[model samples]
Target: MDIKNLSLNPNYNILVTGGAGFIGSNLCEAILKNGNSVRCLDNYATGKPENIAPLLENPSFEFIEGDIRNAEDCLKACKGMDYVLHQAALGSVPRSINDPFTSNEVNVSGFLNMLIAARDAGVKRFVYAASSSTYGDSKNMPKVEDIIGKPLSPYAITKYVNELYADVFAKTYGMETIGLRYFNVFGRKQDPNGAYAAVIPKFVMHLMKHESPTINGDGSFSRDFTYIDNVIEMNVRSITGKNPDAVNTVYNVAYGERTSLNELVELLKEYLGEYDSKISNVEIVYGPERKGDVPHSLASIDKAKSLLGYSPSYDIKRGLKQAVDWYWKNLQ
Candidate 1:
């Protein structure tokens, strides 16, 4: 389905927490592109102002530099907002493993702050970024939303807690909440310099620099890498769709396909090499499996299709090509 076909209330004012991060910034851009007013709240802890630098020029987009953990900030951001897209959180399994407390503070306590603030502000809907990591330790392929395994890391626990809270809020306060369990999302503007940088951008950066990319495991572990445009579509559908059954439900945002790490490296090398032939020779180095990481992840998009009419626009190979092109143009 085309995103422009989705009927949204033009007068609605939206609040996007963590609106300066990769996914959040993209959501902000999409919201503004649809002719809606937006209020963005970000602490800039991991989110950079440069990500939203272009949006600042638009009078419809207003940004408040604030932390989600602060109740006052969340309340202020949520005021007069019709929809709340809470994307602010500390991600990465290794980072959570190193300091679970900080992850809990940002992901758990901060999430609660946003929920309460949004509910109190009388917002129409609350949508937050839930992780595919919430399906931890489950050996199931194409994981469905109803079934999930025990959380393996602090990050997983934090995201799973979001679903739990969303459910309770729906039942108790009559507030509607939707959780989008995003699988390995990658695209332009995804940070490549950080220690906690995601695999796609990190590999793209290495391949561009003619450096060997490291595979975390024996290169067999796989993931259902999702593109940012598909994610943005899901957000738009969740907020604008008229289905009552779709509200307060969690859907897996993915391409319903999996690619191994080794295959992924080859794809990146092939794409980036188009810009520089030498990058084709960039070798891959295998390392030990990361701690607190799941062996595999693949999402079932059937639920999203049946409920939210989520038709992903791009698959892995197509998405990687677009992402590589963007990084090559912008990062170079």
Candidate 2:
């Protein structure tokens, strides 16, 4: 991240909620590298400890072991911060389908708690993680933020509710808020061990072990697979952007292209094969389509580009190679 190019000040203080997770930890790492003061708040329920372990020794980094469900913890984390990056949420559509109560508690209620805390702390801007699932059941190929359809799952509902709350806070309280609706973000440190782990990492892990990965549908389901660096850039741009119109609105953060499940698996095998030639022969299995999943997800990133100056540096192939290399070196 070039601080000069982004027009960011090196001395500013930033707070990252869920800073021990894949996306949050990366944000903390980048901010610290940019010479900014960073405070992280996470309970480690879904977040990994090793993700933030190396950052613990940084002089400019602080971590608070706390959950967003606790209002006091949220207040404590938001104090003395110039900006708040809210990435704390119970993710996964299947998990939410099995248990809606826990999802609502952490995603909706906890999100509200963070908002109130940041408002009280007088944070200059609040940038949060939204989701493309909000466009659930919409027939649109390239998703635009304003043309959202009814949510398909409990988790999607919660994320949509977040956008509502953010708009309310911005309009009613005069707060500066920007919501980024990320589309299938993937990269290093993304956990592949869990049952609800995302497809990319899970498939990578399976391929590395020479095991077949199951595709929920007929391998036609596609996603706008975004890279982590692109996501980090969007967050940083959201916090530093000065456009008045840009605030109080949401933008889709994506690479503007879609990759089908078949294509994705082939790409994974092709890349991982470079490291272990046997990986190229791994077979992909097909299964029933999962509930509450969309057939295709592609985003129109023109809004983010025009408003936040977000130019994604890595495409799917480039980013996947980077991710495959990391998994090979670390997980293998």
TM-score against native, each model: 0.98, 0.99
Off by over 4 Å in 2: 1-4
What would the per-residue lDDT of candidate 2 be over residues 1-332, giving only the tens digit for each residue? 45456767889999999999999999999999899999999999999999999999999999999999999999999999999999999999999999999999999999999999999999999999999999999998799888989899999999999999999999899999999999999999999988899999999999999999999989999999999999999998998898888898999999999999999999999999999999999999999999999999999999999988999998999999999999989997
The candidate that achieves the highest lDDT relative to the unseen native structure: 2
Tell me model 2's lDDT, rounded to 2 decimals.
Answer: 0.94
Q: Estimate, for each residue in 182-217, the C-alpha lDDT of model 1 and write its tens digit.
A: 999999889998889999999888888888888998
What is the TM-score of candidate 2? 0.99
Model 2 clash tally?
0
Name the lDDT value of residue 49 in candidate 1.
88
Shift of residue 280 alpha carbon in model 1, Å: 0.6
What's the CA RMSD for each of the models?
1.1, 0.8
What is the clash count for each candidate, in the order shown? 0, 0
